[model samples]
Target chain A: MKMSGAQMICEAIIAEGIKTVFGYPGGAIMNVYDEIYKQNKFEHILTRHEQAAVHAADGYARASGEVGVAMVTSGPGFTNAVTGIATAYTDSIPLVVISGQVPLSLIGTDGFQEIDAVGISRSCTKHNYLVRTLEELPRVLKEAFYIARSGRPGPVLVDVPKDITGEIGEFFYPSEVNLPSYKPNYKGNNRQIHKAAKAILEAKKPLLYIGGGAVLSGAAEIVRELAWMTQIPAVETLMSRGVMGAKNPLLLGMLGMHGNYASNMAMSETDLVISLGARFDDRVTGKLSEFAKYADVIHVDIDPANIAKLVDVDYPIVGDIKTVVEKLIPLLKEEIRTERYQVWRDILGRYDELHPLLYNDSDEVIKPQWAIERLGELVGEQAIITSDVGQHQMWAAQFYPFDRPNQWINSGGLGTMGFGFPAAIGAKKAVPEKTVINITGDGSILMNVQELVTAAEHRIPVINVILNNHFLGMVRQWQTFFYDKRYSETDLSYQPNWKMLAEACGGIGYDVTTKEEFDAAIKDAIAQDKVAFVNVAIARLENVLPMVPSGGALYNMLLEHKEEK
Target chain B: MEAVRRVISVVVLNEAQVLARVSGLFAARGYNIESLTVAPIPETDMSRITIVTKGNKRVIEQITKQLHKLIPTFKVIEHEEMVEKELALIKFPIEESLSDIQVLCQAYNGGIANVGEKMVIGMVTDEPARVKHFIEAAKRYSPIEIVRGGVVAIER
Candidate 1:
């Protein structure tokens, strides 16, 4: 059947099993919006801002294990989607962003609402295409979906020129994409795999360093099995929080700049570091030469370029994480009672007991960590937690015990400021039956607070628990520790009344300033039939403890001192 | 043991300081590329680069990894189990050996043509490494000059 490019786009998304899309309509994309209205096949969520649309798509992708789709019009609409694209790119989320562009003939002449969407999104996206003709629409759509969901998943942009959307074409979705330039290697060399396995067998103290790629590749079960068989304690990066169930005895929590003291210490002393699906970010490895100095690193990643680029690896396996781990599982000989594993675990346990996370009663307002822990207790293992970046993000990483893969979504690599609100909307949309909550700080929420309208419009019923510390908590904490506590531009003054903000967005809102108030507010938010925001007024001076100061060793953490205040 | 050798063809952005970036990456990663050739695309703002490197499977994989990390590199393809070719034009002296050279060039997917008086140019285009071998073989005939084109590739 002959159809316009706009209609074909909706059809292609439907073919890929997409049931919903988040977007905001505008002039250049009115035709596409009209096509969407005519079919009424898929649900179109109207977000307050285009950024939220992209982020909601990202959240949907992470939760549902499918390509998240978002749409927007030209000019500012296209520009607003950039942050969301960058977030997806940094976290390696699968997103196919479709945006409307000005007419082809008027592209270079600065037509109405015309902007270089393709050029602006080039670096942030895995690949981008401008559909100038009806003939290119079908192939471009198919290729975008394929590239977005394939190896090392990331966002792909397809800018449909306004004139092309009106053109007619026989829409046929291709079953196979034959791009010679984009062949991703999914199998590691047998020799490299064997070498990695042999290194694991020979090492005295082996540690499994996990990251978001493990979850993306669906290698969690294999990773757990390998860790158990080898008796290696696994420490995850922030993005890899839920890849393995946190309750497992062999699991050490997230390790990095704001990671657990014990996990960092263990990483420092490990003799054999088996890193899976993780780039060696600066936060994870303090100094390249000093990182895992005593270890023979075995780096396994799907992207060959990342291997040995940052840190030297004795054994590098480039392939799908799950495939590589599954292959190596059989090759490794089961050594049940390795003394090294026991000794390392014992040391970690000692550190955990000595400097446990503390939040004793004080005259000040409610503590943010207390609120997070209380929420964890109320929600238990099933609740899906999404967080914005800051002290609250780190606290959630520490306090929440995620027991399933993809249960926790946060901006780990990029640390994007306003990720929580929109991400929560996407997560709730992806899994409507599951209870989804956005744990964000007051400072971070303002970055994309308009997304509350998205939740209200879609009736997603996401619980937004704002830890209102009245300051850019992470930066303040840094100034307190590293600098002389000058509080330079860290204080957020003239804050909006969150209750009023939530109510303005057509959602339930509550402000809690004490532990009792916090508990009641959380319970009430979860019970509310619509989107709810519970603002817990936390102590502004409070800091996220167990922090490793800049250039400091993991073992030399500056633990929180009650006497200092 | 005899060293294993392979020729790699790379398509990259043609701009100032791109060659330095590509070659610097290889040098920093300790990859010893034997023969390197680079030139601009005839009708576009892109360049084609051909590199000859010797190594086993592991070393080749390392070289490819380093090459892929270069920002200017558009694509990298190692000529293994693919149709590969290179072209060269050698200006030779007009002599009785012209007919013999023509027969040799034809055997390797090439032909000899007389361009001007006392100067006959023989051209041969084959697999890049094979072309290198041909150039060395033709050196015995006292060829006056030789110019080789950078390699280009297409997946089979």
Candidate 2:
């Protein structure tokens, strides 16, 4: 059977089990849009901007562990999607970004809306293609989905010329991808696994350092099992915040920059560090010379390039995290449920008690931490939570207790502002049965507030809990501590009336200034299955405490605002 | 440790944008490629690309690891110890004494490939380092032009 390139794209998408697509129609993609309209098989959610489209798709993928689909026209459309592409790339989110290009003949003719989409996005994209012929469309689309969802997943772009979409072609999607060079190593070497197991068993104080890989690979169960069996305390990176149950006694909070004192201290003093699916990034391994200085590291990750990149490792096992952890579990025959780690746990417990995460609990204003904590308790542990970058994001990470994998989503790698609301929309769409919430900052909400209109118009029903601080609180906190407190452009006093803005976007809005108001607003949003905005008025001077200063070792936490010594 | 020269080869599907993907990977990681050559096999739908880069052990390992991640990339061979050669053609003014230049080129396995009315072109194929030495020695003969192709390597 013969099909046009546009139809082949649609058929391929349907074949790949992709049910939803976040897209915006444009000049070059008019034919594709027409086909989409004709078929009406795909759920195309029109975002306000191309960036939001890709980000929404990324959020969907992160939430569901499936490839997210996105489409837009060429030139500015591709340019607008660049940030989302890079954001997804850095975080290893799987997304299929389809951009309609100018006709092949008019490609270099300075055609209107013709920009080199493939070349411009080459650096950021994991892989990209500019489709030249109609016959190549199915294979390109097949490869796009295959490459996007396979082996450390990332965004893959396929630029289709406008004419190709209309040109007739033979359509056949491959049952499996045939890229020999791209087969990821999925099983760990038995020798390295044995070595890692031996190291874990021998060490008196073992710390399990986990990251997004644990959650992405669905190895949370195995990780928890290994930690419990070895009686090893664990600390997670910001990306893997919720992999361990928040109430678990052995699981320390996040480590690195804004990590807890106990967690960072544990990392510093541990005799053995069993790194699982987490790269020792600069943020996590501050002052690399001193990071885990005393530990014999056993790092396991799928990406070989990330192994021993920033820190040395005693046992480097390259394989899928889930597979590796499964292999390592049975090797530890010695039961470590005994009190060998009593001293280590006691030391960390003391740190936790001495330097607890605290914020000014002034009666006059609602604290962001209090608001987050309030919602965290009311919302189920399995609720999907996304956050924009800044103080609010830190507050959410600190206050929220996630018990399930993929429950907490945020822009971890790129730290893009305005990621949360659209991401929450995507998450809610992906998992409509679960409650999805976006905890954002006053400064971040303004970056892509137009997304509010997308939610309202589409009835995405995401609860937007904006921590309304009058200043860019995180930057202001940094300036107050690092600089001479000469607050330059950190002031965001001229922000919009968020409640009114939400209402203007045709959503229900509430202005919560106190605990009572916040409780009512949050409860109301969770009760109703509609797009709800609750702007919680938080104090401007509130800072995320227990922060390890940039380039400072993890153990050197600055507890400046603590009341006790 | 100081950076050292390394030869790497990758076999990839003979398709458009494969080269761009390989080059883009290096560029994004800030790894510099000294020289690159690619050619399709006569009977197969695959191409072999050879690249020379200078980096320390860790950097070279990282480059190799990253090269393996490319979708089109089939195999990445980082030459631990390999036989390598590069070709260089040097054009000298016709009036210059050719003996010295010819001796240097002959030692590197080449004589004058061409002797024109105004210029004499000496071609040499040898180990990359020896080719470098030949080019340096031929520079004293008032060479007008020099063209060097990328290195090709095979494991010894």
Candidate 3:
């Protein structure tokens, strides 16, 4: 059927089964926006800024396991969305972003509101396209979704020229893509899977190092089952939380730079490390050469490049994490360990006791860790909690005790600040019945706090728990420990009355300085069926500890309060 | 293992600034591209990109694997067993003996592509190493200028 480029886009989006799209309209994208309005194929969310639109899409994708869609005008519009796109790129979230560019005639002439959108976003995107003619628009749009959601999922961009969106053309969506050289391995090699199973059974101490790929591939249940059947302990990276149940016996807490003592110790001491859908990022492996030195590493990821990028892999199973883990579960069932791991468990248990995840319980003042703990306790870790980067993010990742896959979402790779609130709104939209909360810091919150109006106006009721420490907590912590106390511009003392800011934005707000106030404020925010912000003033100078100093071994953990001499 | 220079050739859908995506991949990953060339393939909807880079076995494999990830990419050839040649053009004063230069170029499949009243242009088509050797060998002629193009290769 012949259709306008904009109409074809709407048709293709409907074909992809997309229910919602977040975007902001501009002159360049007016036609596509009009087509969307006419088709009524998607729930169009008008966000305050282009950046938030992408964040919302990314959050929705991560939380719902759907390919999230975001559209915006070209130039400044897509440039603003760069951070959000880069955030998804780093964490491997499946997202399709459609951006409108200047007309073909104006391209490269620096047309009004036109920058090289494709060029700017090329590196951060899994794949990107700039449609030249109407003939390619339908196929390009289809391929964008296919590329975004397949094979180690990441964000993909399709920049549509304004003229093409207005031009009429024949619309035909291909049933299948024939990317001969781009075929992704979803099924594991039988021989490698069996060898991994044998290695797991023979090893005296085996550790499952799961990452975000497991969550994206829907392999959390399989991962938990493998740990259960094999009686092997596992550790979750920042992105891999909630894969194992809180009560799962074979589970170690979050592992890496700011991870639990037992988890890092287990990673260092294990005989075999089975990495599931997780890249050996610098954060996870403190010092590449010494990381998991005692272990034979088996890496399982959909991306072959991730297998030995940072650390050597003894066995590489390049396939989808969920698929690989599902197949491994059966093979491992027959090869269950004959020897008990009680001794190994005992040592890790002792380590956990010796270096417990600690925070001074302060009744006189509010503690960031306490607030996160109380929030988790009140509404278990089952709620969808997204966090911005900083100490609060690390604290949430560590103390929340996540036990549900896809429930705990954050900007892990890019460590992007200003991502949480908008993302929480998106998550809430994705899973309306579930509670959605943005655990943020003063520094990170202010980055995109303007979105308060979007949440209030749109009735996207997402609660924001701001840890008001008046400083960039993570940077301050580093300076306090490493530097000679030359406190730079890390302080953010000058701030608005957060409660007033929320109230002015037509949202419920509360300022809590004590535990009682914090507890009550959280309850009030949850009970209120409206957008809410709870600003909890936490103790200043507090730090996230058990940090592996830069370039240090995995085992070299630094305590928050070091004993003198 | 020590790092060695490798030539990677990629065929991608001929599109706008696909070279940016091709070269950007290596730069973003901190993989150095010593030399790169791109031109449209005849009678096909594709362009061939040749990138000269230095890396160990693992790094080279990563470069090739990542190249396959780009959307426009249709094929990536690592040139493991291939006939490869890099062209270097030299401009020397007309005073230098054209016969002597031709003899040196003959060693590396060289020829005089252009001759002017003031200067003569000599061309060499050979393995990148031999081209470099020819350029060094022709230096005694005091060549005024040298221009080297990216490597182009075919399966052996």
Most DockQ-accurate candidate: 2
lDDT per prediction? 0.83, 0.86, 0.88
Over the stretch A255-338, how does candidate 2's per-residue lDDT look in tens digits? 888888889899999999888889998888899889989989999988888897877789999888889988888788454444
Question: CA lDDT of A104 in candidate 1?
Answer: 86
Per-candidate DockQ vs. reference: 0.13, 0.75, 0.67
TM-score of 2: 0.97
Q: Is candidate 2 or candidate 3 better by lDDT?
A: 3
Docking tier of model 3: it is medium
Cα lDDT tens digits for candidate 3, A97-158: 99999999999997899999888898899988889989988778888899999998999999
Chain B superposition TM-score per model:
0.73, 0.93, 0.94
Sliding window of 10 residues with minimal summed lDDT for model 3 chain A: A556-565
What lDDT score is found at residue A421 in candidate 2?
Answer: 82
**Model 3, runs deviating above 4 Å:** A560-565, B40-43
Residue lDDT tens for model 1, A40-152: 67888888889989988998999888899999999999999999999998899999999999888988888888998866776677777778679978988999999888878
